[model samples]
Target: MRGPDPWAAPPPPAPGGATGLGGAGSGPGAGRPVSWGREILAGAVVMAAVAAAVGPVLGLLWERLAPRVRLLVGGDALYLENPESQQAIAGDGTFLLLGLGVGLAAGVGVFLLRRRSGVAETAGLALGAGLGAVLAWRLGELLEPDRDEIRELARRLGDGAVIDAPLELNALGALIGPAFGALLAHFLCMALWGPRDPVRRPPVFPRWG
Candidate 1:
């Protein structure tokens, strides 16, 4: 019967054109993968902005409250403030801001590097927090011994200051305060800003003539 009509209009072209049956299209169920780098970068940017806004406000608040808080927190070894001490504290604040900025930049860099790999936003934040904390802690320690007030207090407390004593505890608190502050700042940023997702493009193929 005419060689079975050869192609026969492809059996009426199965509904939905090329997307039907053996068509090349991925169809409704198919989806592209999300990029991780973009998400982390977005998280970092959010954190950075938050830090920038909050740092000065917190610094001011801390400065106002430092004296009273030091009495309770430092016990017998309160970090006394004078012109030099104030200058050192100011330097410590500056160092903290620097740490925050560095943390933000690092977070963004990590996100950029790992965007395509589906990096976890929490992990990235945690890393940033940890790094910031460590940096701030080191900065605080560096500033601590340089403070003439603290040096005087240390001298008064004697070189054999017992670890179990309030003086030692106060010193420990001083060492740890900046680290804790950095952690708080990082956590606040994470809370206020949601993670970001990377933009992706759909796959394309050359059309055949």
Candidate 2:
């Protein structure tokens, strides 16, 4: 018998375009295409936009509703005045823009840290919003109209001796507004553009394995 043909023609290609290197269609070289970085950037941008738009809307609504409820429940005696002169600060278009800028910055930061997907983004946004709200609240308290003025106003409305408590409520409002703004923005982005998954990837090579 002739020596086994050392170089017999390679077996015919498999039907349906299969390759022998890794068994059936497409060898180990084949891989799913991906654009992880781009997707992350896009996700961040969308999240930021969501945060900015929703924040102001929620803030204004809250302001309006809170006062109304206070008036209704407290009757004539219960009153909360919003002494802030800048309506924008109270959830106007300018504040919305500010919120947007802040949100974008947060998103960019998150993206840079490689926390740009799934629940990571959500968590990042939430953390950022909380911090931002706290900062805003403190700043508002610092810049608030003099406590004496509030005391005078309370005195003018008096049913009794006016107790001039430190403006704790004012500070609270300031803090709450930014927090709400951030939350709303985050929610909107998640609803409209957040990643489908919230879980992160497992590391390659199982620790047990």
Candidate 3:
């Protein structure tokens, strides 16, 4: 057998200590330096922006899905076509449903995007979700038939005529749906599968015993 060639490259150093391949340690990232403060702030800002941008989609969905009340024009005023109709309530419910769904989606998205989540990031998620919900609420209302237009329609239609009422969110409290949903989802994810000790990790290389 010939001796090793002079120029041959040496073998790579083994991963573990002499104790053999050590149990899983902090992988290759343990030694790298990280600016956690900056990272957390940046992550929060990014999440907020992304979450806020989704507001329009929520608004559009709310507008399309919300129920409109039916009104009857009689004499000098209009009255509900059916006084007991739940359409008004349904509008608020629709907005709430949409908000919750959007919030859940946002939470899952943030969790997936930030595998190692930070407090600032979580806060940002909530803040963004709240803002998004507000935006959606306002935008949805704006998309509905304007009060002036509805009145004009009622006037033009004259007495004994029925018209679709503008969609309205009677429950202002429904706005919390998005924020509550986001927080709940985020909490669940963190509790169920997040790292046991996010701030701690084993060393990348095992120490010789």
Best-fitting candidate, measured by lDDT? 3
Better candidate number, 1 or 2, judged by lDDT: 2
lDDT of 2 by residue, 71-146 (tens): 1112225333333433323343433345445555554444444433555355546654655544443343454446
The deviation in Å at residue 121 for candidate 2 is 5.2
Model 2 misplaced stretches (Cα beyond 4 Å): 1-30, 67-146, 155-209
Candidate 3 wrongly placed segments (more than 4 Å): 1-40, 198-209
Reference-based lDDT, each prediction:
0.42, 0.45, 0.78
When sorted by lDDT, best at the front, the candidate numbers are 3, 2, 1
Q: Across residues 1-209, which tens digit of lDDT does each residue of candidate 1 receive?
A: 12444434544543444333433432432344456667768657544543443334433433333322122114445443332334434444554454455445544444444342223454444444554444444433443334466546655666444221111112223333433444454455544553533334453333433
On a 0 to 100 scale, what is the lDDT of residue 105 in model 3? 79
lDDT over C-alpha atoms for residue 48 of model 2? 60
Cα-based lDDT at residue 180, candidate 3: 86
Model 3 root mean square deviation, Cα atoms: 8.4
Which residue pairs in candidate 3 have backbone atoms (N, alpha carbon, C) closer than 3 angstroms, thus clashing? Answer: none
Ranking 1 against 3 by lDDT, winner: 3
Worst 10 residues of 3 by lDDT: 17-26
What is the C-alpha local distance difference test score of candidate 2? 0.45
* Candidates 2 and 3, the one with greater TM-score: 3
